[model samples]
Target: MSKEKALAIFTAVPRTHNCAQAVAAGFAREALVDTLHDCGGGRAPEGLCGALHAALLMAPEDRREELRKRFAAGAGSVYCRTLKQELKFPCAECVRLGAALAEEFADKPEIR
Candidate 1:
């Protein structure tokens, strides 16, 4: 998807440099779309935002449960921990950062 279109998905998310970079990188377009759909469909799992980000990173399924545990307290801040440590954006910026990265990654042509 185009970076603009990808960015549109994250319009509601707080914009940040990480998010902008993600959009520029095009890394997790489908995952972000799925996350929005799930969230909109009212079936988003607990700590959905963080889970979505982790999934997009291709985190192992076994790790997902553990990862989810980290943010199970309904604390958005906990969710941000991974993004902050991994991408240098605090929890406040995960949504935007994830979107940006997805867009950025998508815009890149396949290497192989």
Candidate 2:
């Protein structure tokens, strides 16, 4: 899906999505959409930002660290608490960044 469409899903009315779901939606990963159902709102493992967490999970194992580091650099931190309470990074933007990175990997897995 288009990035704008993915972002739109985040606050898409009654069927609004969470950070993780928004990233998964960008990839059109239906199974991932289900897997991340409860992984949002700071509930992702280690309290990682839901969007970052989902993006990392979607990436190839070897690229996960790069994805995480890049995300941290851009978003100020990978943890949801830090992003939200400390860095004041909005969740919607987190979703956007995560989806962007995931799409980057999906589009070109050999770039690294």
Which candidate tops TM-score?
Answer: 2
Over 4 Å off, model 2: none
lDDT of 1 by residue, 5-41 (tens): 4345445356422332333334444544443443321
Each candidate's TM vs. the true structure? 0.32, 0.92
Task: In model 2, state the lDDT of residue 39.
Answer: 87
By summed lDDT, the worst window of 10 consecutive residues in model 2 runs over 103-112
Error of 2 at 89 (Å): 0.5
Lowest lDDT block of 10, candidate 1: 35-44
Show pairs that collide, candidate 2: none
| lDDT accuracy of residue 89 in candidate 1 | 45
lDDT of 1 at 39: 39
Give the backbone clash total of model 1: 23
**What would the per-residue lDDT of candidate 2 be over residues 1-112, giving only the tens digit for each residue?**
5466678888688766788988888778888989899989899999999999889888999889989999999999999999999899998899888988888876776663
Model 2 TM-score, all chains together: 0.92
